[model samples]
Target: MGRILLTGASGFVGGAIHEYLSNSSTHKLTVALRRPMSSLPVTTTLAQIDQIDGVTDWSRALLDSDVVIHAAARVHVMQESSTDPLTSFRKVNVEGTLNLARQAAEKGVRRFIFISSIKVNGEETSLGVPYTACAEPAPADPYGISKMEAEKGLMRIASESGMEVVIIRPPLVYGPGVKANFFNMMKWLYRGVPLPFGAICNSRSLVALDNLVDFVVTCIDHPKAANQVFLVSDGDDLSTTELLKKMGRALGKPARLLPVPSGVLTLAATLLGKKTLSQRLCGSLQVDITKNRELLNWLPPVTVETELDAVAKDFLDKHV
Candidate 1:
């Protein structure tokens, strides 16, 4: 059994990974958190880290770690408060990640798995032209830029220290306990709120939380996953209208959608200073996962319909 160190046990993606790994018999898991959490399994080891920055010491947590899954980061915020947003993101996502990686390498950690975002590839893509693993980096936002920088630094550390770095970039992970935009969409659908995205034909790729967790666990010991960059999704791409309809079916509520023109929606959003939001709703962003299939022989374990059903059930159970 190998010892695995997991950071960001309190966040959405990290928490899901922690839960999945907690039931595993093959690995000893250590969770690094800003503070102690009462909900973690009793046998789980806790490493308290108040903050993550270039200067934050991770010596205690790096002990005897065979694999380090760095999942914590300064996620994008809707209303950013920092005067210098890029610097703020760099401090936590870039500098903090490299700091942890360097320390993990010194501690003889064999593998470092980084949970990155699809934003590292770019904000959007052509309808049929998906970004592949070898795509040129074109991060458009501060959060994406920070993650890209972190990936570059990790690669350097891997070359210099002989530590394996596996990077997985996933887009719009959704399932149980999802928050923000996805959750809002579920709420709107459940409440029978009519949306103006019925006619949007742009495709977007999304990852199910279970599928992502399964892939990450597989990568923990898979020889082919070492020092590799992977782009992951549900193996299914859906337009906004299709997604809403699927979600409505899952929620047992037929969606009430108005046939609004995409151009008109974009214009309205632009007038209201929500151009980015409109783009996200109307623009296509897809990732090609052929490399993942050929290299690791991996496929998303869960189907989109099944995962969306779970999401709908969870939302109904908790929110209703």
Candidate 2:
């Protein structure tokens, strides 16, 4: 069994990775948290992390560790109101990452896996082409800018150190234990309120929790994953209306979609400053995983339909 150190063990993506890797007899995992975080399947306690300096104690965590998955990041909304969003993100995302990575390098950690978001490219999807792994990062928000900058920093670190850096930039992820907009959608759908996204035909790439966990573990051992940037998804696209319908079926409810035109909804949302919500639903943000397929010879095991169904059922079970 190989020992791995993970950060952000208490969050949604972090929790999923911990649970998934813990089940494997070949992997021994340690999660690092700033303080005590509960409601996790794994055991954890307070640990020391250097907030700054040319010196740090993080190398200790890297001792005998096989891989370091830096899942911890300053999420956008969590630190939105700060005076300098970019600087705040840098403090946690960039500086914190270097602290951990430098330690891993000193201690001879084999692989450094970073969980970066597709937002580094852009938040909205384009009409002609989907985002690819090679696309130049043009993050419009603070979160995206921080991640893109960190990628550069890690690259420099990897060149100097022997540790291999693997970057996996994934699009929107949804499934059981999902939060954010997907969770909000579930709540709206359960209320049987008619949604006006029926006419929107934008496509989005979504990865299920199970599928994302599987991909990350695969990268840990895959010889091709080293010094590589990869993009992963369920290899299928789903529209907003289709997603609602699938979710409804999983919850044993009917999708109440109104056949309103997309343009009309856009106008209404614009008037109310609900532009963000409208863009999210009607955005054609898709990711091209051709490189992932060719390089890793891997495809997601779970389908979007099955994943949405699971989410719906889980939501109802919790709320009902």
Candidate 3:
């Protein structure tokens, strides 16, 4: 059993990780939170910090920790409010992450697991040519660029301090408690809204919340995971049309999709200043997890169909 410190305990992904680790008998879990909460499990310890930034002190949280899972960051926002988005992102994602990592290293933390996004590889990929861990980074957005910079800084810290770093880049993660676009799609489907995505055949990879949490736990003590970068997914790719149809099946409401050409949709979206949203729906972004399988012999424990069904059920339970 090892002592582990977890950040972002209140977030979607981080909450799930904390729940999973808190139930485990083999590890001692301590969570760093921006504020205190009364609902946390009694087995878990809390470390409160004012905010995450370049100079946030993490010394108290790093005490006697064997591994640090850095999951909190300035997440990507569809409608960005910041005038200088990159600067805003750098302050949190880049500077904040490096600060925590340096402290972890100095405190003799064995491994630091970073939850990165697949956007580091770029916005889109060729239909059949998914991105690999070794691919050159071509971040197109401020959020992606910030994560890339953080990864670079973490690697430098690892080399100089001998603290191992494990980076996992996951694409769109969806399951219960999901928000953003995925949840929007579910809402549209449930409302029987007609969507013009029947013709969108571009493939995209997605990871389930359970699968991602499982992989993070796997990397905690897996010797082979040290100093490695991995791209994780469900090992299944789906087009926008296919994904909606499957979600519809899970939700007990067949999607009402109108067959619209991808080009026409792109043009309309561009004219309406929603080009990025269109690209997300019409362009392919796939990640190859061959490295994950070969290196750690790891496989996603849950299937997409099962997880999607759960997501639908959860949505219905809460919304209906």
Top candidate on lDDT is 3
lDDT of 3 by residue, 168-252 (tens): 9999999898999999999999999999999898999999999999999999999999999999999999999999999999999
- Estimated TM-score per prediction? 0.99, 0.93, 0.99
Please, what is the whole-model Cα lDDT of each candidate in the order they appear?
A: 0.94, 0.81, 0.95
lDDT of 2 by residue, 42-97 (tens): 43223445343235467555657889988888886732688888888888788878
lDDT of 1 by residue, 120-225 (tens): 9999999999999999999999999999999999999999999999999999999899998899999999999999988999999999999999999989999999
Clash count of each predicted structure: 0, 0, 0
Clash count for candidate 3 is 0
Q: Model 3 reaches what TM-score against the true structure?
A: 0.99
Q: Candidate 1 versus the native: TM-score?
A: 0.99
Mark the regions of model 2 whose C-alpha exceeds 4 Å error after superposition: 36-56
| Reference-based lDDT, residue 270, model 2 | 91
Candidate 2: pairs in clash: none
